[model samples]
Target: MPAFTIVTTSATQDSDAAEVNTLTDDFGSETEALGYSRRMADEMLGLAAQLSLDFDYSNVALYDGDLLEEDLDPDHPALIGVWVLDEEGCSYVPAAEFRESLAEPEA
Candidate 1:
């Protein structure tokens, strides 16, 4: 098993930063992986729009567990990592605070 750090970048600060949720087996190829990730991100942006939420991708980083070898089986690879949606004007809220907010419905 090998660990790989996946970081999603945005050309502008207004883009959404989504963690790669599901990586396919064909991701072994660079082109395939990039395309897959891009599509996933696009879908996420679309969802955000539907929810009337603002998404920003100023920076996104993931630290995979300690593992070496780069080219491994994509189907049975290590951590796929998680994506936390970062919204503008809401960065001050910590994870705990965000959870608390979720407990109450918006008025």
Candidate 2:
């Protein structure tokens, strides 16, 4: 089960969970995966527009889905997909970054 780095552009610095559009599906090839991810970006941008979101630069650019396999470990327990709060907004980090952010309980 491969994972993807989904990106979304937004105007407001704050966007709730509902405003974030996520996708979880495997495709035939890597190209297709990226294509689908970009399409999802379009959907998200449209959504932002409907919500009347405004960006500071009047330019919002979301990232296209990219297969991140550089430092990903499927066996890691903390590699779950979840968004974390940032200065810009809530966004998903890479698998390794997510693991580093976790606070493990004392042994």
| TM-score, every prediction | 0.35, 0.37
The clash count of every prediction, one per candidate, is 1, 0
Which segments of candidate 1 are over 4 A away from where they belong? Answer: 1-28, 58-107
Model 1, CA-based lDDT: 0.40
For candidate 2, write residues 1-107 as lDDT tens digits: 34444433233554342333334455565456556654554555566567766432112112223333333233344233333333354344454554554555546
Which of the numbered candidates is closest to the native, going by highest lDDT? 2
Q: Give the whole-model CA lDDT for all candidates, comma-separated.
A: 0.40, 0.42
Q: List the residue pairs that clash in candidate 2.
A: none
The sequence of per-residue lDDT tens digits that candidate 1 reaches over residues 15-104 is 544333322242344344444444555555566667776655422223233333343222223434323345522122333443455578
RMSD of each: 11.7, 9.7
Q: Model 2 clash tally?
A: 0
